[model samples]
Target: MAKAFASAGDMTEKTISFTEVGEGLYAFTAEGDPNSGVIIGDDSVMIVEAQATPRLANKVIDCVRSVTDKPISHVVLTHYHAVRVLGASAFGADQIIMSDKARSMVAERGQEDWDSEFDRFPRLFEGHESIPGLTWPTTTFSGRMSVFLGQRRVDLMQLGRAHTAGDIVIHVPDQNVMFTGDIVEYHSACYCGDGHFGDWGKTLDAIKAYDLDAIAPGRGDALIGREMVNAAIENTRDFVASTYAPAAKVAARGGTLKEAWDAVRAACDPKFADYAIYEHCLPFNVARAFDEAQGIDTPRIWTAERDKAMWAALQG
Candidate 1:
């Protein structure tokens, strides 16, 4: 039998965990589902990455309520992916922050992404109907922006393009904890549907420059020490390299996309087959890698129709 398209068949619910990685830093992780970070400052809280829907985000709110009574004052979007930002309404944050490029991407492809992601991962959008629509950034910065929550300092920086053209990371310098968006996925497949493979590697290198003690990655378990943080970064780098290297090699030889896909699967499956979303991301990852190998610098915007066609072609 043919495999299900994307994650359409994945209905199994995952156990959620709220781990305190630093003094007041928390990682809200749902098995391998998209993860969100919480930074509790002196007077308020800042959330990194909203859940897929307002109803879904309520659960995260409950988690926050269980720990503190301080209102959530800010929502920081790491990128423009629908699964990560559509739940901003539930936060009731005073400011929804994002990079300027991220805001632009939302204006350009937010609707298409909403439709495409909803079809791809039904389980993540459990309360899809409650989504108030595209989440917009109330505040946008071109490079780096710093927020001082009393004495705590949280810096939002757009290092370079990676998972998306406008990927950003939240750095807590005092606590040495970094909330890296999908730019770094620990023990999870990096979805490259709208990624720049070459630039992503350089971005990873830039992330290493920080002296980090812990990391709240986009997925998987939270990294709690410098050793684990470095390991997660290395693992992410390896996964990206393993996925793209084979496909790029094939494309460099003027091979067909199927050939490139097959090569990548053969190269990556042994190691990453058990990772979350590995199957869901393979087709898109290989497609992007093939394009990059052929000297395509920009990632193509993915629509619902294109998603189905790409999945069908790869599955065939």
Candidate 2:
């Protein structure tokens, strides 16, 4: 029998957890569902990643309300993924910030991504109608930008491209807390549909250079201690390398995409088989890795049509 398309069969709801990892830093995770980070500054709050839609985002807003009354003034898009940035309207943040490369990605394929992701994970888009169309960034920066909530300092830096062409990390220097949007996932499978495997490995190294006390990753539970944080980083690095190395080897031998995909699955399934979204992400991840190995640097836009075609060809 053919496998389910993307996460279409994943209909069960997950219990959400709001854990305070640091003094005012919180991670909103849902049993391996897409996670969001909250950084409470002295005078305002900054939301790291918006949920899928306004209705879903409201749940996050409620979580924020329970903790602090300070208004949310900033919403940062780690990259241009629909599941991450489409819910910006709910925050009422004055500044919707993103890396300049991310802004261009929104302009380039945001609509396609919205349609593609919605179909891929229908359960996650429970409030699809509530989305106010593509969420555009009101402000953008190139390398790094810093925002201060009174005396508290939060740094937003683009530390090379990994998950996407414009991935950025939110750093709280004083707290030693880093919100790595999908750049590093803990226990959860890394979705590499739009990933640059080569650059992604180097990006992980850049993140390790930080003196981190805690990390709220894009998915999975927050890492509280240095040991846990380092372990998560190493796990993510191994996942990326393990997946790409075999696929690259196949491509070097002039093998087909299906061959590369099969080889990668056989190698990775044993280790990451139990991880969340591992099966759902494998086909797309393999396709992107195969392309990169074949010398395709930039990722192709994945439209709803292309998503179906790819799934049918690979899983059918």
Candidate 3:
């Protein structure tokens, strides 16, 4: 039987878990769905990657309330994906931050992404009606910037592109904990529809250099040890490489997109078949890998129409 289009058929609710990975840092994870990080500063709080909707963001807020009474002062969107940013309004954060490239993406394809994602994943948009509009960052930075929540310092850096062009990682220097948004996933599929497959490994190396003690990854579990952290990083590296290699070979030989799809499935399914969103990300990952192999420097914008067309052509 043919698979459901994207994650449209994935409607089961995920169990939410709020884990303290550091002194006051928490990871709000829900099974294999998108995860968010909570950094508790001396005075206020900073949220990393808002959920897909206001109702979902409220869940994170509830978790925060259980731990501390501090006001949430900031919301950092690691990238411009609709699932991560559209929930920013619910945070009531005074500062909404993103990388410069991320801001541009919001202007360029934010609406298209919103439309596409909404149609593709209905469960994530549980409270879609509550979303005000497209989420725009109040502050934008280049390669790196630092935001201080009282004396505690939170460094946001664009450690090269991976998941998306504007991907950034949040580093709590004192705690030695990093919040890597979709850049490093544990037991979860990296959504590469708008990813940079070539630079993803190099970017992983940058994160590894830090040798972080704990990592609240974008999905799956909150990594809390050096061994677990390293394992997840390498696993993510392998997943990306495994997805791209076979597709690149197919593209190199002038194979059709469907051919590339089959080749990637043969290479990746054995290793990452059990991963969350594996099926949802497979087609897009194969397409991007094939495009990059053919010298497509930039990712093509994905619209709702484009999504259906690509799904039909490949999944049919």
Candidate number achieving the greatest lDDT relative to the actual structure: 3
Clashing pairs in 3: none
| Candidate 2: Cα lDDT at 129 | 85
Candidate 1 C-alpha lDDT tens digits along 102-199: 99999999999999898888888987878877899999998899998889999999999999999999999988889999998888999987899888
lDDT of 1: 0.91
Instruction: Estimate the Cα RMSD of every predicted model relative to the unseen true structure.
Output: 1.2, 1.1, 1.1
The TM-score obtained by model 2 is 0.98
Rate residue 138 of model 2 by lDDT. Answer: 92
Q: Judging by lDDT, tell me the better candidate of 1 and 3.
A: 3
Error of 1 at 304 (Å): 1.1
- In model 1, the worst 10-residue window by lDDT is 1-10
TM, every model? 0.98, 0.98, 0.98
lDDT of 3 at 269: 87
lDDT of each: 0.91, 0.92, 0.94
Q: Candidate 1's error at 251, in angstroms?
A: 1.2
By TM-score, highest first, what's the ranking?
A: 3, 2, 1
Q: Write the per-residue lDDT of candidate 2 for residues 1-316, one digit (tens) a residue.
A: 5556748998998999999988899999998888999999989999999989888799899999999999999999899999999889999999999999999999999999999998888998997888888999999999999999888899999999999999999999988899999999988999999999999988988999996899999999989999999999999999998899999999999998788889999889999999999988888999999999999999999998898788777764
